[model samples]
Target: MASKKKRVKLKSLSQGRPPTLKPLHSLSSKATRTLISSHHTLQKLRAKAVAEGDEAKADAIAKEIEERGGIEKYQHASLLGQSSDRGGDSSRILMDWLVPIVPALKQHASDGRQMRMLEIGALSTTNACSNSRLFEMERIDLNSQAAGIKQQDFMTRPLPNDTKDKFDIISLSLVLNYVPDAIGRGEMLLRTLEFLKIPHHLDSGCQEIFPSLYLVLPAPCITNSRYLDESKLEMIMDSLGYIMVKKKLSNKLVYYLWRRVSFSTKRTCFKKVEIRSGKDRNNFSIVLK
Candidate 1:
Protein backbone atom coordinates (compact mmCIF):
# COMPACT_ATOMS: atom_id res chain seq x y z
CA MET A 1 0.00 0.00 0.00
CA ALA A 2 1.18 3.52 -0.75
CA SER A 3 2.51 5.34 2.27
CA LYS A 4 -0.33 7.07 4.02
CA LYS A 5 -0.46 10.74 3.11
CA LYS A 6 0.93 12.85 5.92
CA ARG A 7 -1.78 14.69 7.74
CA VAL A 8 -1.39 18.35 8.53
CA LYS A 9 -3.33 20.76 10.72
CA LEU A 10 -3.05 24.48 10.35
CA LYS A 11 -2.35 26.36 13.58
CA SER A 12 -4.06 29.71 13.96
CA LEU A 13 -0.71 31.50 14.05
CA SER A 14 0.49 29.55 11.01
CA GLN A 15 -2.60 30.68 9.11
CA GLY A 16 -1.31 34.28 9.49
CA ARG A 17 -4.00 35.03 12.14
CA PRO A 18 -3.21 35.99 15.71
CA PRO A 19 -3.66 33.19 18.26
CA THR A 20 -7.18 32.85 19.67
CA LEU A 21 -7.75 34.81 22.85
CA LYS A 22 -7.86 33.09 26.22
CA PRO A 23 -11.03 32.95 28.33
CA LEU A 24 -11.77 35.84 30.70
CA HIS A 25 -10.91 33.61 33.65
CA SER A 26 -7.39 33.11 32.31
CA LEU A 27 -6.96 36.83 31.67
CA SER A 28 -8.52 37.98 34.91
CA SER A 29 -6.48 35.74 37.17
CA LYS A 30 -3.37 37.84 36.54
CA ALA A 31 -5.33 41.06 37.10
CA THR A 32 -6.78 39.71 40.30
CA ARG A 33 -3.31 38.80 41.57
CA THR A 34 -2.12 42.34 40.86
CA LEU A 35 -5.08 43.78 42.78
CA ILE A 36 -4.35 41.55 45.76
CA SER A 37 -0.74 42.70 45.68
CA SER A 38 -1.85 46.34 45.65
CA HIS A 39 -4.08 45.72 48.66
CA HIS A 40 -1.16 44.20 50.51
CA THR A 41 0.87 47.29 49.68
CA LEU A 42 -1.80 49.50 51.14
CA GLN A 43 -1.86 47.40 54.27
CA LYS A 44 1.87 47.77 54.58
CA LEU A 45 1.55 51.52 54.30
CA ARG A 46 -1.06 51.55 57.03
CA ALA A 47 1.11 49.38 59.25
CA LYS A 48 4.02 51.74 58.75
CA ALA A 49 1.83 54.71 59.63
CA VAL A 50 0.77 53.04 62.88
CA ALA A 51 4.31 52.05 63.78
CA GLU A 52 5.49 55.62 63.35
CA GLY A 53 2.65 56.85 65.62
CA ASP A 54 1.26 59.03 62.83
CA GLU A 55 -2.32 58.35 63.80
CA ALA A 56 -3.73 61.05 61.52
CA LYS A 57 -1.89 59.67 58.53
CA ALA A 58 -3.01 56.16 59.39
CA ASP A 59 -6.58 57.34 59.65
CA ALA A 60 -6.34 59.16 56.32
CA ILE A 61 -5.00 56.08 54.59
CA ALA A 62 -7.74 53.95 56.15
CA LYS A 63 -10.32 56.46 55.04
CA GLU A 64 -9.01 56.33 51.48
CA ILE A 65 -9.45 52.57 51.43
CA GLU A 66 -12.94 52.87 52.83
CA GLU A 67 -13.85 55.45 50.20
CA ARG A 68 -12.59 53.16 47.46
CA GLY A 69 -15.23 50.53 48.25
CA GLY A 70 -16.70 50.21 51.72
CA ILE A 71 -19.83 52.10 52.72
CA GLU A 72 -19.18 54.66 49.96
CA LYS A 73 -20.93 52.43 47.47
CA TYR A 74 -24.09 52.71 49.54
CA GLN A 75 -23.95 56.49 49.56
CA HIS A 76 -26.63 58.14 47.47
CA ALA A 77 -25.65 58.01 43.79
CA SER A 78 -26.89 61.57 43.25
CA LEU A 79 -24.49 62.76 45.97
CA LEU A 80 -21.55 61.60 43.84
CA GLY A 81 -21.42 65.04 42.20
CA GLN A 82 -21.92 67.63 44.88
CA SER A 83 -20.36 70.28 47.08
CA SER A 84 -21.19 71.31 50.68
CA ASP A 85 -23.08 74.56 50.10
CA ARG A 86 -24.96 73.70 46.92
CA GLY A 87 -26.26 70.35 48.17
CA GLY A 88 -26.04 67.04 46.25
CA ASP A 89 -27.64 66.10 42.96
CA SER A 90 -30.08 63.95 44.89
CA SER A 91 -31.25 67.00 46.85
CA ARG A 92 -31.49 68.91 43.61
CA ILE A 93 -33.68 66.25 42.08
CA LEU A 94 -35.94 66.38 45.14
CA MET A 95 -36.08 70.15 44.94
CA ASP A 96 -37.05 70.06 41.29
CA TRP A 97 -40.11 68.04 42.17
CA LEU A 98 -40.85 70.23 45.20
CA VAL A 99 -40.64 73.67 43.57
CA PRO A 100 -43.94 73.41 41.73
CA ILE A 101 -45.73 72.45 44.91
CA VAL A 102 -44.37 75.41 46.83
CA PRO A 103 -46.74 77.97 45.33
CA ALA A 104 -49.67 75.69 45.95
CA LEU A 105 -48.69 75.31 49.60
CA LYS A 106 -47.92 78.99 50.00
CA GLN A 107 -51.41 79.82 48.78
CA HIS A 108 -52.85 77.67 51.51
CA ALA A 109 -50.54 78.90 54.24
CA SER A 110 -51.70 81.70 56.51
CA ASP A 111 -50.90 85.12 54.95
CA GLY A 112 -49.17 83.56 51.91
CA ARG A 113 -46.12 83.00 54.07
CA GLN A 114 -43.21 80.67 53.32
CA MET A 115 -44.15 77.07 54.02
CA ARG A 116 -42.58 75.22 56.94
CA MET A 117 -41.35 71.68 56.26
CA LEU A 118 -40.60 68.65 58.40
CA GLU A 119 -38.07 66.03 57.25
CA ILE A 120 -38.19 62.61 58.88
CA GLY A 121 -35.29 60.15 58.76
CA ALA A 122 -33.00 62.77 57.35
CA LEU A 123 -29.86 60.79 58.12
CA SER A 124 -27.62 62.52 55.59
CA THR A 125 -28.12 66.10 56.90
CA THR A 126 -28.33 67.21 53.27
CA ASN A 127 -32.09 67.03 52.86
CA ALA A 128 -34.47 69.93 52.17
CA CYS A 129 -33.44 71.46 55.49
CA SER A 130 -30.22 72.62 53.85
CA ASN A 131 -32.05 74.72 51.28
CA SER A 132 -32.91 77.84 53.27
CA ARG A 133 -34.47 79.74 50.41
CA LEU A 134 -36.92 77.02 49.44
CA PHE A 135 -38.41 76.01 52.80
CA GLU A 136 -38.40 76.48 56.53
CA MET A 137 -37.24 72.97 57.29
CA GLU A 138 -37.72 71.14 60.57
CA ARG A 139 -36.36 67.69 61.18
CA ILE A 140 -37.62 64.63 63.12
CA ASP A 141 -36.31 61.11 63.55
CA LEU A 142 -36.89 58.15 65.83
CA ASN A 143 -33.21 57.26 65.96
CA SER A 144 -31.71 59.87 68.20
CA GLN A 145 -28.27 58.24 68.19
CA ALA A 146 -27.66 58.20 64.44
CA ALA A 147 -24.53 60.15 63.64
CA GLY A 148 -24.33 63.29 61.51
CA ILE A 149 -27.98 64.31 61.84
CA LYS A 150 -30.42 65.78 64.33
CA GLN A 151 -33.39 63.84 65.68
CA GLN A 152 -36.79 64.23 67.27
CA ASP A 153 -39.44 61.81 68.48
CA PHE A 154 -42.42 62.74 66.35
CA MET A 155 -43.96 59.32 66.88
CA THR A 156 -44.44 59.14 70.62
CA ARG A 157 -45.92 62.61 70.95
CA PRO A 158 -48.07 64.43 68.43
CA LEU A 159 -47.12 67.87 67.13
CA PRO A 160 -48.67 70.39 69.51
CA ASN A 161 -52.17 71.37 68.45
CA ASP A 162 -51.19 75.04 68.66
CA THR A 163 -48.39 74.42 66.17
CA LYS A 164 -50.42 72.12 63.92
CA ASP A 165 -51.29 75.06 61.71
CA LYS A 166 -47.64 76.05 61.38
CA PHE A 167 -46.09 73.63 58.90
CA ASP A 168 -47.18 73.75 55.28
CA ILE A 169 -45.11 70.83 54.04
CA ILE A 170 -43.99 67.54 55.59
CA SER A 171 -41.56 64.92 54.35
CA LEU A 172 -41.23 61.28 55.33
CA SER A 173 -38.05 59.99 53.72
CA LEU A 174 -37.06 56.37 54.00
CA VAL A 175 -38.59 56.12 57.46
CA LEU A 176 -41.67 53.92 57.20
CA ASN A 177 -39.43 51.01 56.30
CA TYR A 178 -37.79 51.07 59.71
CA VAL A 179 -40.98 50.95 61.73
CA PRO A 180 -41.19 47.53 63.42
CA ASP A 181 -44.79 46.56 62.69
CA ALA A 182 -47.83 47.42 60.58
CA ILE A 183 -49.83 48.82 63.51
CA GLY A 184 -46.88 50.87 64.66
CA ARG A 185 -46.21 52.08 61.12
CA GLY A 186 -49.84 53.03 60.64
CA GLU A 187 -49.86 54.81 63.97
CA MET A 188 -46.65 56.59 63.05
CA LEU A 189 -48.28 57.87 59.86
CA LEU A 190 -51.31 59.12 61.72
CA ARG A 191 -49.22 60.70 64.42
CA THR A 192 -46.94 62.37 61.88
CA LEU A 193 -49.86 64.06 60.12
CA GLU A 194 -51.56 64.75 63.36
CA PHE A 195 -48.53 66.71 64.46
CA LEU A 196 -48.88 68.74 61.28
CA LYS A 197 -52.54 69.42 62.08
CA ILE A 198 -53.79 67.76 58.86
CA PRO A 199 -57.31 67.23 60.03
CA HIS A 200 -58.02 70.83 60.95
CA HIS A 201 -61.40 71.38 62.60
CA LEU A 202 -63.94 72.36 59.96
CA ASP A 203 -65.46 74.83 62.41
CA SER A 204 -62.02 76.46 62.45
CA GLY A 205 -62.15 76.87 58.67
CA CYS A 206 -59.26 75.31 56.72
CA GLN A 207 -56.52 76.53 59.01
CA GLU A 208 -54.02 75.63 56.29
CA ILE A 209 -51.66 73.55 58.38
CA PHE A 210 -49.45 71.23 56.38
CA PRO A 211 -51.15 71.32 53.02
CA SER A 212 -48.63 69.03 51.30
CA LEU A 213 -46.46 66.01 52.07
CA TYR A 214 -43.58 64.38 50.23
CA LEU A 215 -42.82 60.73 50.96
CA VAL A 216 -39.76 59.00 49.50
CA LEU A 217 -39.77 55.26 49.95
CA PRO A 218 -38.39 52.18 48.30
CA ALA A 219 -40.87 51.32 45.47
CA PRO A 220 -41.85 47.85 46.58
CA CYS A 221 -40.56 48.51 50.13
CA ILE A 222 -40.83 44.79 50.90
CA THR A 223 -37.18 43.80 50.48
CA ASN A 224 -36.30 44.74 54.04
CA SER A 225 -38.01 42.86 56.83
CA ARG A 226 -38.94 46.13 58.53
CA TYR A 227 -40.46 47.69 55.40
CA LEU A 228 -44.16 47.81 54.50
CA ASP A 229 -45.46 47.63 50.94
CA GLU A 230 -46.17 50.89 49.13
CA SER A 231 -49.83 50.01 48.59
CA LYS A 232 -50.56 49.65 52.28
CA LEU A 233 -48.70 52.82 53.09
CA GLU A 234 -50.65 54.67 50.43
CA MET A 235 -53.88 53.32 51.85
CA ILE A 236 -52.93 54.73 55.23
CA MET A 237 -52.21 58.12 53.71
CA ASP A 238 -55.52 58.04 51.84
CA SER A 239 -57.33 57.34 55.07
CA LEU A 240 -55.71 60.51 56.40
CA GLY A 241 -57.12 62.59 53.51
CA TYR A 242 -53.94 62.97 51.48
CA ILE A 243 -54.12 62.61 47.68
CA MET A 244 -51.22 61.43 45.60
CA VAL A 245 -50.42 64.07 43.01
CA LYS A 246 -47.08 62.79 41.70
CA LYS A 247 -45.36 59.41 41.73
CA LYS A 248 -41.84 58.67 40.51
CA LEU A 249 -39.96 55.39 40.40
CA SER A 250 -36.30 54.76 39.74
CA ASN A 251 -33.79 52.05 40.41
CA LYS A 252 -33.09 53.52 43.83
CA LEU A 253 -36.36 54.88 45.28
CA VAL A 254 -40.02 55.68 44.75
CA TYR A 255 -41.24 59.20 45.56
CA TYR A 256 -44.82 60.24 46.15
CA LEU A 257 -45.96 63.83 46.49
CA TRP A 258 -49.30 64.25 48.24
CA ARG A 259 -51.61 67.19 48.78
CA ARG A 260 -54.79 67.69 50.73
CA VAL A 261 -57.67 67.86 48.25
CA SER A 262 -60.26 69.26 50.68
CA PHE A 263 -60.91 69.58 54.35
CA SER A 264 -63.84 67.85 56.13
CA THR A 265 -67.09 69.15 54.59
CA LYS A 266 -70.28 67.89 56.15
CA ARG A 267 -73.59 69.47 57.18
CA THR A 268 -73.53 67.47 60.39
CA CYS A 269 -71.35 68.66 63.25
CA PHE A 270 -69.81 65.16 63.46
CA LYS A 271 -66.14 64.92 62.41
CA LYS A 272 -66.58 62.41 59.57
CA VAL A 273 -63.68 62.01 57.11
CA GLU A 274 -63.78 60.56 53.57
CA ILE A 275 -60.41 59.65 52.14
CA ARG A 276 -59.37 58.14 48.79
CA SER A 277 -58.45 54.49 49.34
CA GLY A 278 -58.45 52.28 46.22
CA LYS A 279 -56.35 52.55 43.08
CA ASP A 280 -59.38 53.82 41.17
CA ARG A 281 -60.14 56.45 43.78
CA ASN A 282 -59.53 60.01 42.60
CA ASN A 283 -60.66 62.46 45.29
CA PHE A 284 -60.92 62.50 49.09
CA SER A 285 -63.30 64.61 51.13
CA ILE A 286 -62.89 64.81 54.88
CA VAL A 287 -65.69 66.10 57.08
CA LEU A 288 -63.92 67.48 60.15
CA LYS A 289 -66.74 69.97 60.70
Candidate 2:
Protein backbone atom coordinates (compact mmCIF):
# COMPACT_ATOMS: atom_id res chain seq x y z
CA MET A 1 0.00 0.00 0.00
CA ALA A 2 1.21 3.48 -0.75
CA SER A 3 2.17 5.49 2.36
CA LYS A 4 -0.69 7.76 3.47
CA LYS A 5 -0.05 11.22 2.15
CA LYS A 6 0.24 13.80 4.92
CA ARG A 7 -1.79 16.86 4.05
CA VAL A 8 -1.17 20.27 5.54
CA LYS A 9 -4.11 22.54 6.05
CA LEU A 10 -3.60 26.25 5.65
CA LYS A 11 -4.86 28.40 8.49
CA SER A 12 -8.09 30.16 7.78
CA LEU A 13 -8.01 33.96 7.59
CA SER A 14 -10.42 34.18 10.52
CA GLN A 15 -8.58 31.68 12.69
CA GLY A 16 -6.28 34.20 14.39
CA ARG A 17 -6.15 37.96 14.77
CA PRO A 18 -8.46 39.72 12.35
CA PRO A 19 -6.79 40.48 9.03
CA THR A 20 -7.35 44.19 9.70
CA LEU A 21 -5.14 43.93 12.76
CA LYS A 22 -2.12 43.45 10.54
CA PRO A 23 -0.13 46.45 9.35
CA LEU A 24 -1.45 47.86 6.08
CA HIS A 25 1.97 47.64 4.49
CA SER A 26 2.14 43.92 5.26
CA LEU A 27 -1.38 42.93 4.20
CA SER A 28 -1.52 40.32 1.43
CA SER A 29 -4.12 40.23 -1.34
CA LYS A 30 -6.10 37.51 0.42
CA ALA A 31 -5.97 39.37 3.72
CA THR A 32 -7.16 42.63 2.12
CA ARG A 33 -10.15 40.94 0.47
CA THR A 34 -10.99 39.16 3.71
CA LEU A 35 -10.91 42.36 5.70
CA ILE A 36 -13.14 44.23 3.23
CA SER A 37 -15.66 41.39 2.94
CA SER A 38 -15.81 40.86 6.68
CA HIS A 39 -16.40 44.55 7.26
CA HIS A 40 -19.22 44.74 4.70
CA THR A 41 -20.90 41.65 6.19
CA LEU A 42 -20.65 43.04 9.71
CA GLN A 43 -22.18 46.32 8.53
CA LYS A 44 -25.09 44.40 7.03
CA LEU A 45 -25.65 42.45 10.21
CA ARG A 46 -25.56 45.61 12.26
CA ALA A 47 -28.09 47.28 10.00
CA LYS A 48 -30.45 44.33 10.27
CA ALA A 49 -30.13 44.21 14.01
CA VAL A 50 -30.92 47.90 14.32
CA ALA A 51 -33.91 47.61 12.01
CA GLU A 52 -35.26 44.79 14.18
CA GLY A 53 -34.93 46.98 17.29
CA ASP A 54 -32.38 44.63 18.78
CA GLU A 55 -30.11 47.08 20.55
CA ALA A 56 -28.09 44.37 22.24
CA LYS A 57 -27.40 42.62 18.96
CA ALA A 58 -26.56 45.87 17.27
CA ASP A 59 -24.22 46.84 20.08
CA ALA A 60 -22.46 43.50 19.94
CA ILE A 61 -21.94 43.84 16.21
CA ALA A 62 -20.64 47.35 16.67
CA LYS A 63 -18.17 46.11 19.28
CA GLU A 64 -16.96 43.45 16.91
CA ILE A 65 -16.52 46.10 14.23
CA GLU A 66 -14.44 48.16 16.59
CA GLU A 67 -12.29 45.17 17.50
CA ARG A 68 -11.84 44.51 13.82
CA GLY A 69 -10.24 47.97 13.58
CA GLY A 70 -13.26 49.86 12.25
CA ILE A 71 -13.89 51.34 8.82
CA GLU A 72 -10.36 52.68 8.71
CA LYS A 73 -8.94 49.24 8.23
CA TYR A 74 -11.45 48.35 5.58
CA GLN A 75 -10.64 51.54 3.67
CA HIS A 76 -6.96 50.76 4.00
CA ALA A 77 -7.51 47.33 2.53
CA SER A 78 -9.50 48.84 -0.35
CA LEU A 79 -6.72 51.32 -0.99
CA LEU A 80 -4.18 48.55 -0.92
CA GLY A 81 -6.16 46.61 -3.47
CA GLN A 82 -5.98 49.71 -5.71
CA SER A 83 -2.21 49.81 -5.52
CA SER A 84 -0.28 49.12 -8.74
CA ASP A 85 1.00 45.77 -7.56
CA ARG A 86 -2.50 44.50 -6.76
CA GLY A 87 -4.56 45.79 -9.72
CA GLY A 88 -3.57 49.45 -10.21
CA ASP A 89 -7.06 50.97 -9.84
CA SER A 90 -10.67 50.70 -10.99
CA SER A 91 -10.52 54.08 -12.71
CA ARG A 92 -8.47 52.40 -15.42
CA ILE A 93 -11.61 50.73 -16.66
CA LEU A 94 -13.63 53.95 -16.49
CA MET A 95 -10.91 55.72 -18.46
CA ASP A 96 -10.84 53.00 -21.10
CA TRP A 97 -14.58 53.28 -21.62
CA LEU A 98 -14.46 57.08 -21.71
CA VAL A 99 -11.66 57.28 -24.28
CA PRO A 100 -13.97 57.16 -27.27
CA ILE A 101 -16.17 59.97 -25.91
CA VAL A 102 -13.32 62.30 -24.89
CA PRO A 103 -13.63 64.50 -27.94
CA ALA A 104 -17.38 64.89 -27.49
CA LEU A 105 -16.93 65.59 -23.81
CA LYS A 106 -14.27 68.15 -24.66
CA GLN A 107 -16.63 69.99 -27.03
CA HIS A 108 -19.32 70.06 -24.34
CA ALA A 109 -16.80 71.43 -21.85
CA SER A 110 -15.72 74.27 -24.17
CA ASP A 111 -18.28 76.54 -22.57
CA GLY A 112 -15.76 77.29 -19.78
CA ARG A 113 -17.30 74.66 -17.50
CA GLN A 114 -15.70 71.26 -17.01
CA MET A 115 -17.78 68.09 -17.01
CA ARG A 116 -18.78 67.17 -13.46
CA MET A 117 -18.67 63.74 -11.86
CA LEU A 118 -19.78 62.40 -8.53
CA GLU A 119 -17.73 59.38 -7.57
CA ILE A 120 -19.36 57.57 -4.67
CA GLY A 121 -17.29 55.26 -2.50
CA ALA A 122 -14.16 56.89 -3.81
CA LEU A 123 -10.94 55.54 -2.31
CA SER A 124 -8.41 57.67 -4.14
CA THR A 125 -8.40 61.23 -5.43
CA THR A 126 -5.47 60.61 -7.77
CA ASN A 127 -7.08 58.06 -10.04
CA ALA A 128 -7.51 58.42 -13.79
CA CYS A 129 -10.64 60.57 -13.62
CA SER A 130 -9.11 62.83 -11.04
CA ASN A 131 -6.07 63.41 -13.26
CA SER A 132 -8.17 64.14 -16.32
CA ARG A 133 -8.60 67.77 -17.34
CA LEU A 134 -12.07 67.30 -18.78
CA PHE A 135 -13.78 66.32 -15.54
CA GLU A 136 -14.34 68.12 -12.26
CA MET A 137 -14.76 65.25 -9.83
CA GLU A 138 -16.54 65.25 -6.49
CA ARG A 139 -15.35 62.28 -4.49
CA ILE A 140 -17.34 61.05 -1.51
CA ASP A 141 -17.40 58.08 0.85
CA LEU A 142 -19.07 57.16 4.12
CA ASN A 143 -15.67 57.26 5.70
CA SER A 144 -12.99 59.57 4.42
CA GLN A 145 -9.53 58.03 3.96
CA ALA A 146 -7.81 61.00 2.39
CA ALA A 147 -7.76 64.79 2.36
CA GLY A 148 -9.78 65.23 -0.82
CA ILE A 149 -12.54 62.67 -0.34
CA LYS A 150 -15.48 64.14 1.55
CA GLN A 151 -16.98 62.04 4.34
CA GLN A 152 -20.55 61.89 3.13
CA ASP A 153 -23.13 59.18 2.68
CA PHE A 154 -24.47 59.16 -0.86
CA MET A 155 -27.94 58.09 0.26
CA THR A 156 -28.36 61.18 2.45
CA ARG A 157 -26.65 63.58 0.12
CA PRO A 158 -29.01 66.36 -0.83
CA LEU A 159 -30.78 65.85 -4.15
CA PRO A 160 -29.79 68.27 -6.84
CA ASN A 161 -32.39 70.88 -7.67
CA ASP A 162 -30.62 72.20 -10.74
CA THR A 163 -28.70 70.77 -13.66
CA LYS A 164 -25.69 72.69 -12.40
CA ASP A 165 -25.96 70.76 -9.17
CA LYS A 166 -26.37 67.43 -10.94
CA PHE A 167 -23.45 65.50 -12.37
CA ASP A 168 -22.63 64.63 -15.97
CA ILE A 169 -21.47 61.27 -14.67
CA ILE A 170 -22.10 59.33 -11.50
CA SER A 171 -19.80 56.45 -10.67
CA LEU A 172 -20.93 53.91 -8.10
CA SER A 173 -18.09 51.45 -8.15
CA LEU A 174 -18.37 48.63 -5.62
CA VAL A 175 -21.12 50.63 -3.89
CA LEU A 176 -24.45 48.84 -4.40
CA ASN A 177 -23.06 45.65 -2.88
CA TYR A 178 -22.28 47.59 0.28
CA VAL A 179 -25.99 48.18 0.95
CA PRO A 180 -27.18 45.88 3.70
CA ASP A 181 -30.57 45.00 2.25
CA ALA A 182 -32.27 44.46 -1.07
CA ILE A 183 -34.60 47.39 -0.53
CA GLY A 184 -31.65 49.63 0.26
CA ARG A 185 -29.90 48.57 -2.93
CA GLY A 186 -33.02 49.37 -4.93
CA GLU A 187 -33.33 52.74 -3.25
CA MET A 188 -29.72 53.45 -4.11
CA LEU A 189 -30.30 52.66 -7.76
CA LEU A 190 -33.33 54.95 -7.88
CA ARG A 191 -31.54 57.71 -6.03
CA THR A 192 -28.80 57.88 -8.66
CA LEU A 193 -31.30 59.11 -11.26
CA GLU A 194 -31.86 62.21 -9.19
CA PHE A 195 -28.21 63.14 -9.30
CA LEU A 196 -27.43 62.72 -13.00
CA LYS A 197 -27.58 65.68 -15.36
CA ILE A 198 -30.54 65.65 -17.76
CA PRO A 199 -29.22 64.84 -21.20
CA HIS A 200 -29.91 67.38 -23.95
CA HIS A 201 -28.76 65.30 -26.92
CA LEU A 202 -26.64 62.27 -27.85
CA ASP A 203 -23.09 63.01 -28.97
CA SER A 204 -20.98 61.19 -31.53
CA GLY A 205 -19.01 58.23 -30.21
CA CYS A 206 -19.21 54.48 -29.64
CA GLN A 207 -21.11 55.66 -26.54
CA GLU A 208 -23.34 58.68 -26.08
CA ILE A 209 -21.95 61.68 -24.22
CA PHE A 210 -25.23 62.11 -22.43
CA PRO A 211 -25.54 61.82 -18.65
CA SER A 212 -24.67 58.25 -17.69
CA LEU A 213 -23.99 55.85 -14.86
CA TYR A 214 -20.73 54.01 -14.47
CA LEU A 215 -21.61 51.01 -12.34
CA VAL A 216 -19.13 48.41 -11.19
CA LEU A 217 -20.17 45.31 -9.31
CA PRO A 218 -18.74 41.97 -8.30
CA ALA A 219 -19.32 39.55 -11.18
CA PRO A 220 -20.58 36.86 -8.85
CA CYS A 221 -23.45 39.10 -7.71
CA ILE A 222 -25.02 38.86 -11.16
CA THR A 223 -23.46 35.64 -12.47
CA ASN A 224 -23.88 33.34 -9.48
CA SER A 225 -26.80 34.85 -7.62
CA ARG A 226 -30.03 32.97 -7.04
CA TYR A 227 -32.11 36.08 -7.70
CA LEU A 228 -30.08 38.08 -10.20
CA ASP A 229 -28.41 37.66 -13.57
CA GLU A 230 -27.61 39.73 -16.64
CA SER A 231 -31.19 39.66 -17.89
CA LYS A 232 -32.66 40.69 -14.55
CA LEU A 233 -30.21 43.56 -14.25
CA GLU A 234 -30.97 44.73 -17.77
CA MET A 235 -34.68 44.61 -17.02
CA ILE A 236 -34.26 46.59 -13.84
CA MET A 237 -32.21 49.26 -15.61
CA ASP A 238 -34.59 49.45 -18.54
CA SER A 239 -37.49 50.15 -16.23
CA LEU A 240 -35.45 52.91 -14.64
CA GLY A 241 -34.92 54.61 -18.05
CA TYR A 242 -31.33 53.46 -18.45
CA ILE A 243 -30.05 51.69 -21.54
CA MET A 244 -26.82 49.79 -21.28
CA VAL A 245 -24.29 51.01 -23.82
CA LYS A 246 -21.15 49.19 -22.79
CA LYS A 247 -20.49 46.23 -20.56
CA LYS A 248 -17.35 44.33 -19.65
CA LEU A 249 -17.11 41.20 -17.57
CA SER A 250 -14.08 39.81 -15.84
CA ASN A 251 -13.67 36.75 -13.68
CA LYS A 252 -14.19 38.82 -10.52
CA LEU A 253 -16.13 41.92 -11.63
CA VAL A 254 -18.59 43.41 -14.11
CA TYR A 255 -18.58 46.95 -15.50
CA TYR A 256 -21.46 48.77 -17.18
CA LEU A 257 -22.10 52.13 -18.78
CA TRP A 258 -25.81 52.94 -18.75
CA ARG A 259 -27.04 56.11 -20.43
CA ARG A 260 -30.19 57.78 -19.23
CA VAL A 261 -32.36 57.67 -22.32
CA SER A 262 -35.82 58.40 -20.95
CA PHE A 263 -36.07 60.49 -17.83
CA SER A 264 -39.76 59.93 -17.10
CA THR A 265 -40.16 56.18 -16.98
CA LYS A 266 -42.16 55.02 -14.00
CA ARG A 267 -40.53 52.63 -11.57
CA THR A 268 -41.38 48.98 -12.13
CA CYS A 269 -42.14 46.64 -9.26
CA PHE A 270 -39.35 44.11 -8.89
CA LYS A 271 -39.53 41.55 -6.13
CA LYS A 272 -36.99 39.05 -4.99
CA VAL A 273 -37.57 36.22 -7.43
CA GLU A 274 -35.36 33.19 -7.72
CA ILE A 275 -33.91 33.14 -11.22
CA ARG A 276 -31.35 30.40 -10.68
CA SER A 277 -31.26 27.32 -8.52
CA GLY A 278 -28.01 25.96 -7.23
CA LYS A 279 -26.72 24.98 -3.83
CA ASP A 280 -23.64 27.07 -4.39
CA ARG A 281 -25.46 30.13 -5.72
CA ASN A 282 -25.36 33.28 -3.61
CA ASN A 283 -28.41 35.24 -2.43
CA PHE A 284 -27.40 38.58 -3.98
CA SER A 285 -30.46 40.49 -5.22
CA ILE A 286 -31.99 43.92 -5.72
CA VAL A 287 -35.69 44.60 -5.15
CA LEU A 288 -37.34 47.62 -6.77
CA LYS A 289 -40.29 48.32 -4.52
The model with the greatest lDDT is 2
For model 1, the run of ten residues with the poorest summed lDDT: 12-21
Inter-residue clash pairs, candidate 2: none
Q: After superposition, how far is residue 226 of candidate 1 from its true place, in Å?
A: 13
Give a tens-digit lDDT track for model 2, residues 93-173: 888878877887778679666778999999988988898767888999877678999978787788887888998889999
Best by TM-score: 2
TM-score of each: 0.49, 0.88
Clashes of each: 4, 0
lDDT, model 1, position 263: 50
